[model samples]
Target chain A: MSQTFSLAIDAMGGDNAPDIVLDGLELAAERHPKARFLLIGDEARIGAMLARRPRAAKLCMLRHAPGVISAEMKPTAALRQGRNSSMRLAIDAVASGEASGVVSAGNTGALMALAKIVVKTLPEIDRPALAAITPSARGDVVMLDLGANVQCDARNLVEFAVMGDTFARAVLGLTAPSFGLLNVGSEELKGDERVRQAAEVLRESHIGPNFHGFIEGHDIAAGTVDVVVTDGFTGNVALKTGEGALKLMRDLLRQVFTSSVPARMGYLLARPALDRLREWMDPRRYNGAILLGLNGVVVKSHGGTDATGFAHAVDVAMDMVTHRFNDRIREGLSMLSTPARVPVPATAPR
Target chain B: MSQTFSLAIDAMGGDNAPDIVLDGLELAAERHPKARFLLIGDEARIGAMLARRPRAAKLCMLRHAPGVISAEMKPTAALRQGRNSSMRLAIDAVASGEASGVVSAGNTGALMALAKIVVKTLPEIDRPALAAITPSARGDVVMLDLGANVQCDARNLVEFAVMGDTFARAVLGLTAPSFGLLNVGSEELKGDERVRQAAEVLRESHIGPNFHGFIEGHDIAAGTVDVVVTDGFTGNVALKTGEGALKLMRDLLRQVFTSSVPARMGYLLARPALDRLREWMDPRRYNGAILLGLNGVVVKSHGGTDATGFAHAVDVAMDMVTHRFNDRIREGLSMLSTPARVPVPATAPR
Candidate 1:
């Protein structure tokens, strides 16, 4: 087995804590046989859980952490009191170069605050954005600024576009991923001044060929572009709105299929087809939320997720590490800094 | 027949113009026998189409409009060059006291600009907002600022809340509608400075009893509040995202239900249940996009919508006129102008 990568996990984060975390590691270990884990949490609890999962125990090394950050803890308070907490230590592992990345299912605000402070950001990146994979009409689409920066300026938006483009290439395995800036309307004159300015900057950048201009919310699901770029406020709202709509549809479908005996019989006959639909829409398949533009890869799994969902989150981090995601982002930024086909003035040094 | 209401129709606005417009009027005429229409369009084509629809012809008076605004025309260009166009004439009919309201399926930007300029806003309203009815898990919810005012200040948000509250009561037949401000997170300190300031103003107002506090985007589809208020940028994005998600699910379900022979047979047995689902999700049921805060009611039908969708738009206008929607809005604004209880200071005037 190859032993080139290691991931630090907050074993005490999330609802199920050590048990679900250990079981999730077992599932991830089965898929990534070479991966090693640095599990940070209560040593006694983790040891007992690991005893039941031999496959995970073989690949994981346990580290004791005396404190735990509660799910309800605020970011400021958590950072002040959570220095020795499992979540913070796991992040510290990545900062200290002991682990390639960090994964947690803890309080989102606390995790973001600690990760931003501990893992740090790339030299060129002002803020790290939270990106996730969403199921679209054509396939998966990458959307960012899920809740990282509340109010982004034009510069922030341009930065997000560059980060999102690199992320789509790394995670989705696309060679030349196309991107679109999210706006109310697709017209050049639509939306606010900030959005129009960002569009103009993107239009003149090195990535102009792959930039698909402004796209509306519907285009996100239409798979009109590989990447969707937006400010945190809009992106977060769009994400939750889509999730709520899906839930409502699922509930309505359940009611329809169970309203009558004939419908029940039809459901039985179509069980295999229904299963395929469920698998396709399963939340576990699209579980990971990557905090991009950071120095080390950091992923946040859903707090209520089971082993399968947690495994998917680990897989996302592994994909980033294996592909050297940060290096690609740096290269993309360099290209952005130097414009293509622009002649330098004679007075300036070339 | 009663002659209390007359609506100005932009017959040359939509894709399948004159014919669809006449047909939709026919359907609407049947439902509201007392209502009359002032049709503004190319007189030759409208008269030809109206000959077949005796019901609509009985209530319609055709007027000639030599100019027509193309769908590709920008709002500014359309306004400057389209003074004699069908859309402008329709608005002029309302301004001239010949019609109670105006309904059009034209270029949205052109329609908005013309309506705001000719129809004008109410004295208390700084800006006219676009509001729409959205289907939710619980029932119908009213969402405002769909795309009119992009960047809203705290005062603008408060005004939208009051307007949305009155709109929900007038059109949706709600007695005491509840309100929620859309934010990235549900926490009090979750959003940007403007959202927080808006929340504070709402909290201190007489409408505080009906205010549902800050809500995330998911609450829109979950029907957590009767009225959802936000800046135009975020609301537009959320609205389209929800629509896109619904479309994606519909497409995916089609593929799943027709994948195999057994699944095909199952679909036949489940046809009745599926039909019910289709009726529930029909776009025609929620077709109208109302321009609120205007002196007169203005509804924009989807440009690509058919006769049935256009009829729905007319129905929304009739409901507002019959209910005296603008009167109700004035009453609500008066209540906002006078607070429930005043905490007078030593130097304040009584």
Candidate 2:
């Protein structure tokens, strides 16, 4: 805690750009006084914003980048032409060890592609996955592969489980977090072959004691486990579905509260309780989507998030860097690779 | 409309068993006065329950079923051992022409397996899909392949689209419904090869005009399309995720409303408006899951649902039977199989 660490910030990313980025940095700086930031963007614009925020200015070292990745740009296009882009420069900072981690709110696909090529994945992982903290009935749950790989084999899924376990330990502060493989049903023969194979391997591996077996979609919100792992396609769909459902309920609640005069008065009386509920369910509290299995930490903030949400993303990056998330993943993978010890026979000599 | 049709009911299915089944039958009978029911279960129990409901007794024909399929029994095990089970006999009634359709609140897997073998599939259909009506922001949305086939190829997806289209027309009363293939993103290249291939085929088929291309998980609740189509694995997960999210919101709302005296009074004043919201969001309104692509209509009710929910399942069955769902599917498939008409050049001979 005594040593200062630096995080690379993509100042030109997100909907609000350098303004919110700088404001978020000021807030993050206040929280982590020992943390320094390498702000990567157009130097002139970033320098102007830093002048207004004394706290962020005191801790920031600005770096110039001329280009920005648009949300609609294809990953391939971004990779080909976004060499001097703020996102690329920020990731480069992590790869070159100029910073311990990088945080961006730009296009997700572009970030994943650029980060994989520049910062590289851990040697033990076949493919890196997108992991995010989602609100559940019991508390927050970690789910992986929100949309990194369109299709995955059994090996990729097993790797996701390992990353998810380390992620829960590092970020959620759970020592022995239970995890489940997402599937159609909890039965042994329910999902596709890939999922079944993954379950089998997890059951026999070192982390088998914490594996809760196959879980269905509802289990995500039910907080059936601390971590949920699946192929990118299914995981992405489930995450979005949950978001959409929550949005629908919120909209309906608003409609109900404004339906009549009685309802309006009731809303006034219930405002405090409802406010507590709203705060508990706020999307800003769970803004960061960490791309796990990378050699260095990478957190992707929601593109539309404001200063507070962006600051939460920085907090996630700081936690990962300080907790040595990648080191834990390395240890977990080694444990997985080691075969289970067989019990010695009583008749045989020890 | 002039002819009376009989529906076979599995009296021993569901958590409540013969009691709710008969009560639901009485309600269904009141709605469809001309309809008759072949109540298949333990004759004595069904007869005893029917005695309490005069309307259901007047319209029901009691048939003895010696066995019942447990919810936890596997599909294959049920197939081999459930010959005289209420669920199997109800399906047999449809196959034997004793009833126009079959409705069960039994084990979904058993119902699907038995219905597929007994009722058989439409000649043009390669695989039958589990289609259900889900509540969406715009209204009711039809989603297919809820969990019939865990692994589906492009062909299966294309067929599901055809079935979904007919299902929307027959059950939801939509003349032309917009349908989309569910994926990770809305882009053409966002999903796996199977989805892209299916999209290509759908784009060129007869339903091309109504095809909405690729949609993400959020689109299901957004009602971006009238029908949401996907492989069983993803579709099932998405469905349950949506359900889970809604449940979470409802639970939170209740906790907020009862958190204190002021909140409790607020609940009383808002009771009417909240009741309307509850009705609109009620899972019972959308209880039936239809097994589409089969020769005869088959509806599965939620096992834990009460009498009112069971009645909704019977209503769905009646709608499919009256609308001739399979016949429409046949027409749609024939159109798909027949190549699109080619436009001749004006300069060339026609």
Candidate 3:
């Protein structure tokens, strides 16, 4: 709990900008007393906000960043024109070795582009994937390539599996986490050639024993595996669909509880237990989406999140830094590169 | 109601086979009154079950099929060796003009393959898509390509849009249902080339006014559009993910209500209202998945569903038959084939 580390913060990012960023820093400061922050944003504004929060001020050092990246800015445009932006400066800090990690709630496309271009990807990684912890029936499950790569080849999928496995271990503390490649069916012949090829490689690699072959979408929420590997397009859709379904259920539950006087009374009697359910399902508990396979830790918080949610993102970055997530991924990749004991056939039987 | 139309039933299909099939027929018999059924299965087994249901027996003609296709049978194997299977015979009834449609609670892969080969695709449709009704916050939403074609070209997507639009009109009674192509984002340049090309074609087509450019997965449950069109892989994953999330929420709610004595008392008082919510969200209500763009109506019921769920599938087929769903699609396809008012740019700006 007393481990010393520093994270570069994008103070002028997200919807509420400096306010929520500073407030979240205050909460994070209380939790990680030994951790230091280099707040990169408009100096005058961040300085004024820090003046109001004595706790955040004690652990934060203001770094002036005059420019700001808008939510609607294109990734390519942001990279070309956002050299002095807060998001850019925060990432720069990580690249320059001034901070161990960077946390941003800015435009996701811009953040990914900047981090990949500035901080760069790990040597063995083809592409750095967007990985996040999603809620499952049994517990938290990790899913990756969430809109980072719309089209993924077999090699990319194999890399994602390695990164996801290392991620679950470093963050979730799973000793030997089980993972599955997302497919239309659990059968080997379910998906396209690329998916089938990826499955074959995983089945023959170092992680073969822990590989669950293939899993359907329901298996995600059913907690059939600890890590779910998928292409960016499908993963993004599945993640959003899960979120929308949960929202619909919550809405319907609210309507059911307020339908009549008796129903309202029932809600009052069940308030205690219902509150526990609410706490368990809180979106803030799973806010940070790490850009895995990157040379340095990069976490993207939900743009619309509040102080508590932002604080949770910081916690995720801290965990990745302290636990040496990148180092674990490097080890996993090396193990994957080791030749298989039994040579896999050129075209494995489906 | 008295305008008679016959449907072939695969009585030797599903987990509960003849019993649930017969019970479903009895229910459908009451609802349709004058509708007749050509029940295909083992003679002795189906006959005995039908004889017990006086209402179903009064409106049914038994067609004995010697074989039954197991759920695990591969599509190729089913097509090659399952000539006399109840499912095959049922689809054959449609092909031979003995029945207007066919309903089966059998292997989905076998059902789709058999239906494509036997019932055949429409003249204008490049490929048939699997379309199903899903619950949304606003109302029922139609999603397509749930697992028919793993990879689709721009033409296949445009065809799906036209068929989906017609389906909404015939089944959901939405005269001008707005539709959106599912993607990672609503931005023009977000997805692969195929999706972008499909969007351009749809925007220039006859249904252009009713076409929402692009939609994310959450748009399905938000009811932002009536029809959500995507390739088989993503659609299948999104559908199951939504189902899994709903199941998770339901399980959580049950746990909350049974956690303590007061919570149990609260459940009793709120039973009536919660019952309404349960009925509204019942999976049986959305049991049928129609194979769209086919020459004849082909409905696939969930293999493990019970009598009520089977009956719902029958209801969906009946709706398609009575509403002249195929005729509507023919008209829609003609409209699409007509020359556009303005020539779409070969490479439209993103």
Candidate 4:
């Protein structure tokens, strides 16, 4: 077993809580034998859940935590309270070097706040953003600020582009991702003043120099662009739309498949092929929402994440650590600071 | 024949120009014998293209114009010079009462500028918006400002709700449509300052009394909200994203179907059912990009539209006229005008 990496899992994090969290840990461990885990929550709840799965034994260890972070409390308040909460302990496990990363399906805002206050950002990064990978026509497309740092300055947007690029390269394996600024129109000046200003700065990013100018909302999964960048507000709206669209399509496809005898027979023949196709788009297989650009690694999942979703999130942490995402981010930023390709003149520094 | 509903066609408007435009005019004329068209463009090009088309004795008429609107020029500047251009002549026909509406596939900005300067907004309408119907999971979703106004205030957003609701009712043939404001999150206060304020205004709209409140991007096709409203910037992005997603899915499905022998066999067996599915998802069938709230009727089609695409756009114009979409918009807005939804507060009579 490789003891070089570990993931702190908040056993009490999701709507399914310890049960799903523990199941995910077991699944990830089986796939990644070298992995190690720390399960933090009510010891009894986690213990009982893991007892139900004897095979999970060699992969995980448990640590007791007294409090839990609720989804409703403000992010900062939750983080402040999470000092003793299991979710925070998972984060602390990494900060304290007991683990390499943390995974949770807890309050998204709390994870973000705790990661920022506890883990800290790289030297130059102003704020961290939430990035989600959508299985696009071309493959996976990284879109960010799904809902973090709502009000951003032009510089904050520049940081988002840089962070998103790193996540794409590190997570999605795109060497030099094609980045796009999500705008209302493809025209050069077609959005709010902030978006317009951000476009200029992003266009000037030398770190991710392959920026593909502006992209529209409809372009998110078009496979036309590798990375779609936007402020947290816009990103969140776009992300929600994607989720809704997928669900809607799935429901419609289900109806069509079961419509009649001929349709049912056709669906039966198409079943295996559809299975393979779905495996490619399956959210569980691709689960992971990295809070990019944070000093420490934090991976989030749906609050109702099942055993598989939780495992994917934990594996996401393992990938971040394995790739040394933060280290590379720092190196790339430093390189840009020295002499970015699209040089931002000293006088024009954002 | 309905003599009051003649339309002028800009023969040189689309990328295919006179050829496709004339083809669409012929198809549309066959469907609506009352619909007459004045084909405005170079007489030589029109004559050349018409020579190939079956000569209809009772076909639409043609008018010659020497100038053409180049796709490259600035929108306002193009409008100013295109007065003698084919597109301008088409708009002029509507303005001069020679035609009831104009159809063009030229630059949208130029079209809007021409419509605004020539035909002008309705009695109480402040700005005209471009509303395009995009293919949704269910059918088609009407999204406004696909590229109309960029910077809009709360009042403008409220206007969009009224306009969109009216379009939904008259254009989409829905009764008392459910309205939704597009925001980053579905929460009431979770968007840009403009969206937050717009939400408040829209929620109170007499026309939006049945408003479904804030909707995220995914709701565009979820069939949850009948009409999703946002500024032109976001709306345009959402509209384009929908377009791109449809294209991406089609391409992906094609690739999957042809990847393996089993998949191909499955596709063959299901060809009939799949064909119906394809027809339902085809972007061209649902074609029509209506410039809503304009002083006069103008619809933009795919710049690369074929006869079918152009025919659909023309069909949209006819339907709007037949349903009196513009008149309905005015009525909807009147019922939703500021401070008129309720009796004045006694304490705030001033």
User: lDDT score, residue B307, model 2?
Assistant: 91
Enumerate the candidates' DockQ scores in order.
Answer: 0.49, 0.49, 0.56, 0.36
lDDT of 4 by residue, B1-350 (tens): 23343677888886888778878876777787766667788998787677666532156677899998877767778766777998888888877778778889887778778888887778777677888776566666767766687656666777788888888887789888787888776766466666676666666668656788888877887766777777776677667666666566667678777777866776776677778777776677767777777656787777888998898888888788777777888888788756634432222000
**TM-score for chain B in model 3:** 0.95
> In candidate 2, what are the lDDT values of residues A192-244, reduced to their tens digit?
77787778778888899999999999999999999999988889999999999
Give me the candidate number with maximum TM-score. 3
Please give each candidate's TM-score. Answer: 0.95, 0.95, 0.96, 0.90
TM-score of chain A of 3: 0.95
Q: State the C-alpha lDDT per candidate.
A: 0.86, 0.88, 0.89, 0.75
Candidate 1, which segments miss by more than 4 Å at Cα? Answer: A1-5, A337-350, B1-5, B337-350
- Provide all candidates' interface root-mean-square deviations: 8.1, 10.5, 4.9, 6.1
lDDT of 1 by residue, B30-102 (tens): 9988888889999988888898999998988898998899999999999899999999999888776678899
Which prediction has the highest DockQ against the true structure?
3
The lDDT-based order of candidates, best leading, equals: 3, 2, 1, 4
| Candidate with better DockQ, 3 vs 4 | 3
| Residue-level lDDT tens digits of model 1 in A1-350 | 23324789999999988777888999998988888888899998888889789888888899999999999899999999999999999998888888889899888999999999988999978788999998888889999889898777666778888889999989998988899999999989998777787777788887888999999999988999999999888999998899888888888888878878888877877779889888888888999899988888999999999999998999999898888898988888777745422332222100
The complex in candidate 1 yields a DockQ of: 0.49
Which regions of candidate 3 fall more than 4 Å away from where they truly are?
Answer: A1-5, A337-350, B1-5, B337-350
Score candidate 4 by DockQ: 0.36
Off by over 4 Å in 4: A1-5, A72-84, A92-98, A185-196, A202-204, A338-350, B1-5, B47-59, B137-139, B337-350
Tens-digit lDDT string for candidate 2 (B297-344): 899999999999999999999998888777888999889844422221
Q: For model 4, how does the per-residue alpha-carbon lDDT over A217-276 read when each residue is reduced to its tens digit?
A: 777877678888887766776776666666565666676677667667766776777777
